[model samples]
Target: MAHVRRDKKKLLTRIRRIAGQVAALERAMETEADCSDVLIQIAATKGAMHALMMEVLAGHLSEHVVAGKTERGRAEEARTIMELLAKYAR
Candidate 1:
């Protein structure tokens, strides 16, 4: 998590932006904005969430999972990673 500390400011900035977007989404719903407009915002929120998850997951796998496993054992981990990636793929 030391690396996270190093990137804390940048991460916080992104999270704050996401929070703002979520608030905007709430506003849009309360105001009964156009259906397409709300859907577009929802899509953007989903993309932002996915990007955040990808960053955290990549860091965790590199720092913890791969670091603890042997080269041979990494193949199984790689396969699992690939499957998860495929599941998330657009």
Candidate 2:
């Protein structure tokens, strides 16, 4: 997430798409759409969120974890990223 401020618009676009997917999922649930269809929508939303996370993670890895000036800063960034990955994998 290192470049979030610089890439605000891009991140917002990704978030907006995820929001639209969530809305669609809600509509599907309200309409009693097929279980499989709802599952598909859910998967799409999850994918969108995962994609956004990956984008931010890449920036953080390059700009902070790998390129940080101090070893302590880099180690901290790496720890943060590992925690995020652990959560995301679940």
Candidate 3:
């Protein structure tokens, strides 16, 4: 997780921005903004999330996945990556 610590500040910044976007999206819904506009906001939020996911995945690949020695460890790493991909690839 030391690698994670290196990017912690940048990651938190992205997370906070995403939070703000979500709040704005909620407010837009409450105010009954145009449907198209809301959908655009949703797309932006999803994109931001994907960027964050990639950063995490990159860190994992470099710090653990590639260097994992045991078959079980590699399998676990692959499973984790696949699960996230499947969930997000919907």
lDDT of each structure?
0.80, 0.92, 0.89
Clashing pairs for model 2 are: none
Q: TM-scores of all models? A: 0.71, 0.93, 0.86
* lDDT tens digits by residue: candidate 1, 1-90: 554776778788888889998999999999999999999999999888888778766775776467845776677767777787888786
Tens-place lDDT per residue, model 3, 1-90, is 667899999999999999999998999999999999999999999999889989988898877778888878888988988898899889
Index of the highest-lDDT prediction: 2
User: Best to worst by TM-score, what's the order?
Assistant: 2, 3, 1
Runs in model 3 deviating more than 4 A are 69-72
Better TM-score candidate (2, 3): 2
Task: Report the number of clashing residue pairs per model.
Answer: 0, 0, 0
Measured with C-alpha atoms, the lDDT of residue 70 in candidate 2 is 100
For model 1, name the residue pairs that clash: none
Which should have the higher lDDT, number 2 or number 3?
2
